[model samples]
Target: MPDNSSYLVVPSSVLWLLGFAVVSISILIIATMVLRARRLRSGMHAAGATEPTGSLLPEFEKNGQSAAASLVQWSPETLRHILAKELPDAQVIVVSNREPYIHNRKGDDIQLVVPASGLVSALEPITRACAGTWIAYGGGSADRLVVDENDRVEVPPDSPSYTLRRVWLSEEEQQGYYLGFANEGLWPLCHIAFTRPIFRASDWESYEAVNRKFADTVVAEARNERPIVLVQDYHFALLPRMIRERLPEAIIITFWHIPWPNSEVFSICPWREKILEGLLGSSIVGFHTQFHCNNFIDSVDRFLESRIEREDSAISYGGQISLVHAYPISIEWPPAHLGKLPDVAQCRRRIREKFGLAEDVKLCVGVERLDYTKGILDRFDALDELLKLHPEWIGKVALLQIAAPSRGTLPAYQQLYEECLHRADDINQRYGREGYTPVLMVTEHYSQVQVYEIYRAADVCMVTSLHDGMNLVAKEFVAARDDEQGVLLLSMFAGASKELLEALIVNPYDAATMGDALLQALTMSQEEQRQRMQRMREIVRDNNVYRWAGSMLLDAARLRKRVAVDRAVGAAPAAPGNVISLLDRKRVAAL
Candidate 1:
């Protein structure tokens, strides 16, 4: 009876105290979980570690994991071992239009700037890994200040490894080959971006001269040794053939960085046949997506008399076969602590202060080169529509458009730049407040650290490329979001959209739809943002620039083996006294 009375007499105050304790413990558990997740996220970013999301190439899998480890996790030594195993005794030589490190005169001292390019990010590691040579156009003002008599220097200056062999291009050569032929001709011709390609005979001649120059340099570097020559992008469409002519024993692999239009569209190029013949000199030719590969193959089939092996995706002509393949390029994941650096907060603060943005105002950032293909004008249109539809976000959201000037000499690019400024001005005039402009357009070139700071500070990153090979800015933004916060509004036209499915994909042409998407991105909950960003970060971290390079090299190696076998079976004649081919034959025989 005493125990029963004691139980029944339990005080309401005691019950309230117990309930409070239970509630506090629950909150503590949730908070701990949230903190633990954040710590794990930070650690993964720092380590460039990612949970495997299947494999990009199932054939290159060992125990359900890709042989090519995440760039963050894989060392240069690891990559070297892989290259040795894949193509033993073969030296790698990379050819590209853009140099990895450009030396410029910063006041009196020589300053090296790494240009913004997916090619540099992808191939530079391969060169470092294998101690290979990188042949590129020396367009920097002070390029000669660093190079030796051989036009060669070890890079990057901070931690030098591998050789950088620069091919000097005169201002006129650069203007005609790069700005005229590459940008005005091959660029627009391949992109399907509605920009009419301007093909000039002088431009074509300059392009040819540049290719020959690069070929001569590669031949000198190889010097009686048959090396693996990787020709990059449209700037060197004729480079593969030119190199092949010089070193017939060389294993040439050309990777076209832009999209290949349908045969109908590509027929507009007066030099289409020559371009096809030049590309066909490669043992392998790669594109960013399968659609591009198919387009290239179809174009060759339609325009040329080459025997198309549809099953193998190979074009047979000139006593050689060139295989067409897809290799989607990506960005190098920044050091895990990049966003967590002590200076990042200061950088973010500086950017905010520079733009006069308030603490509560959310940032929507767009980083792009001022070019017609980048859809800078379309992005502004979407922003204008966004403010009109959602009046509530008028002062709450601000767009920071960082338009890096590109090809300023080109009339189309110049017009695009002027149009971008005009559109941004019009938007600001309509929706801007006294202290807040809806769009803060920054046209100056920003250092990598500055760009990373901008990426880290943004609540949303808009990649509205009208058409692109693989818009790497989308991947870069994903890599910079170490806090697992931010939304990605990626253009459906970009090749990255195929891989980054978690992003809010929209057509840059649809302003109303994009405006609604902007609203959705702005209003997306913290949990939703974390989920989307986490998935994208994992994808980008796993399929990084190293993986892209490794995958391409692996395919090239496979094609090399196949070609050698085909030659052995009398598909083509092996060059007499070609020790390289002999070694390859012996290796194939042993296998």
Candidate 2:
């Protein structure tokens, strides 16, 4: 009676409906959590099973006969055996921008230097095992001196196992194709690290021309009709399509070794359609994670009118279905560098002596190229905060930053190099005493042995990337610490975080939290370090680079067989002179 309309009383039926909806939502969330828990439990239980199960190559039936499912103890030897068995007639061809080994002029002699690249580290071992041909741009100073008349040279000067085909690029081509488009445009676009991507028509043109150049080289290098081509990284996105167009029967597997942005983010790129279409030309498109694969699929949905079969993770376009999958890249187990490094005690003592630091002082290592996306500034800022917050650690804990010079010609990278030096200098000025520098910044390129020595020496290894495909440094750290003593502070943004579960995952954006993580790593007990490191080691060991390569190769083999059957049954037409990869070529030759 007293303004009942203003009181806004709900009806009993409506109230019941609202309550029921709320209950249903809550039940759904709880059920989801319960299911997730059950899955984790089941996985843990399955880990104890003695029966062999395929962890990478899934059980697939062909022509009503199922392939025997067996878990591979993935090693270099095992990988070779599998490669030989999977595609006996095909060649293994690895194509990338950076050569595995660089020939630099060292005074009067040519020095065979291995570039500090995660790509090289991962693929070199596989090539060695398979005796594959690695085709890359010849950017090194003395690259032309060692190559034969055919622009090819056998690598591993100590023990030649594979061919290194060098593709010469002019100064303009290097500037526009590599530093301009690849790094400035695509790299920053893919990784939203606050830097605006610089896209130019000239850079795009050069990129296309370079891709064409590489494609011609690839076609010329193909000894077999259908080579198993592994087109590596962003630099070769267009190369896949170029090769596919020419050699329709060639099985091209393109592995994007970087993070793929969401549709909205990728929409900013003007050539997004071309890049997407180029990538789709592969028989398989691989990313470091499923999240990236999803982002790529979403981008393709927005930009291209391709048929995306969500169930199979395959994209159909131009009468071809490209299988998109996650192949988490990893470092080699018992790293090649490991055999060259000294014992932990010796490493610690020698590094401290070299740096003129006391033995008791803690050494924290952060290794990266002088690139903004690596969050080197954030790492320095976090260390600065840690020192400021904890005065007791002022002279006790030191950060040894190992920054390798990369793309110095780029304005952004040059600025980063300067800023990092200034920042390190400021911190040192504020906190340093004679023989007690809080921050030791080394910018010179270090060999694998020296890097591994530092890894073994440091009590903590920090990889704080703003965003990364998969920072192999994290895995490399775990591999180097076979003594199971070092702690790894990894960025949550890195793809490696998904695999290295035992690492101290921190957000690179949060300085305070990262500082705390550093403190935690510094103060962690030896036993705890051993436990965490042991877990990471097992993960790295089981899922090594050999396993990574094996997984891709296995999937490629399955697809090849499928295509062969299709052709045999006249379901698919055959192209003339088809078949093989850098691996397929060398491995077939090796066979």
lDDT of 1 by residue, 455-545 (tens): 8888889999888988888998898887788899999989898788899999999999999999999999999999999999888876677
- How much is 458 displaced in model 1, in angstroms? 0.3
Among all candidates shown, the one with the greatest TM-score: 2
Q: How many clashes show up in model 2?
A: 23
Once fitted onto the true fold, the runs of candidate 1 whose alpha carbons sit more than 4 angstroms away are 1-77, 334-340, 343-347, 560-591
Please, what is the whole-model Cα lDDT of each candidate in the order they appear? 0.79, 0.84
Q: Candidate 2: deviation at residue 350, Å?
A: 0.9
Model 2 per-residue lDDT tens digits across residues 400-459: 999999999899998998999999999999998877988899998988888898999999
Shift of residue 399 alpha carbon in model 2, Å: 0.3
